[model samples]
Target: MNKTDLLKSIIERLEIDLDMIQRAAQTAYETATAEENIAENKYDTLSLEASYLATGQARRMEEIRQACKAYQQLTMRDYDPERGIQISNLVQLEDAQGNQQLLFLGPEAAGLQIGTGPSKVTVITPRSPLGQQLLGKFEGDEITLVLGNGRQVQEVVSAW
Candidate 1:
């Protein structure tokens, strides 16, 4: 999988999310200001609830905008095996049971999955527990993951 293509996909997804949020925010704002929604009494809070929804939507929109900016400004580069894994690297890991997982280390938007089937890659941020264990780890290195009450071990199969 090409890193450039992956980054492009991420940016595109973020843009789509931003567009949806903008529309929702606009609708919420309209609902909040509509004459029909105006509070008729202390017990009637339709307008107030709409306003709160609008505010939350606005905050979400700003977050998506910032995420877009972050992804756009992200620098994509080839990983050096000798230097170990880092952000922008696509890593493949194999668990003790031989199940392989593909992960893309990114600066943000963790848990976003791109592509499908074997070509699929899950975005992970350095702050994530598994991501923290993978940082600076080279191919063939073993990393342990704590899941619920069980511990699983995985080996770095490849990274680039």
Candidate 2:
């Protein structure tokens, strides 16, 4: 689906904070618009040199719009944990170092220490490298994670 469709799906499935998204989008839009206005001399801000910056600022505003559209689309996906590896699933895993890390893949704000409620679940987005490696891996699976200096280790602890 397109970005708007994806956003709708995300809103339906995940426990996201809508206010945060709205605030960020608005702030970005406003900042971009203000910069554009200043650059174009639409408002009393700077010298003629300011207009040159407006074009770049306008482009930034479009970038923000595109990002919003993309993020909106993302909110509209199936968040089933008991299915194929996806952003909505909580993947409790340990790398080869035996260090267990809990990942909760939700909207940006949802990444913070979320609760363990009925609708709440840890998440790991499939787009991430670690998340990609965990896909299709079942319990008791052994894997390696590459870290600094090309060092790799086998994950032993498989507890969730």
- The candidate scoring highest on lDDT is 1
TM-score of 1: 0.94
Q: Per-residue lDDT for 11-116 in model 2, tens only? A: 4433333344445556545555564545554665553434445455555456445534544555433433354435544445565546565554533323334334
Error of 1 at 138 (Å): 0.5
lDDT of 1 by residue, 11-113 (tens): 9998999999999999999999999888888999988988999999999899879878989999986878777999889999999889998999998888889
Lowest summed lDDT across 10 adjacent residues in model 1 is found at: 75-84
TM-score of each: 0.94, 0.43
lDDT to native, each model:
0.92, 0.47
Model 1 residue 154 CA deviation (Å) reads 1.4
Q: Model 2, stretches more than 4 Å misplaced?
A: 1-17, 24-89, 95-97, 104-122, 154-160
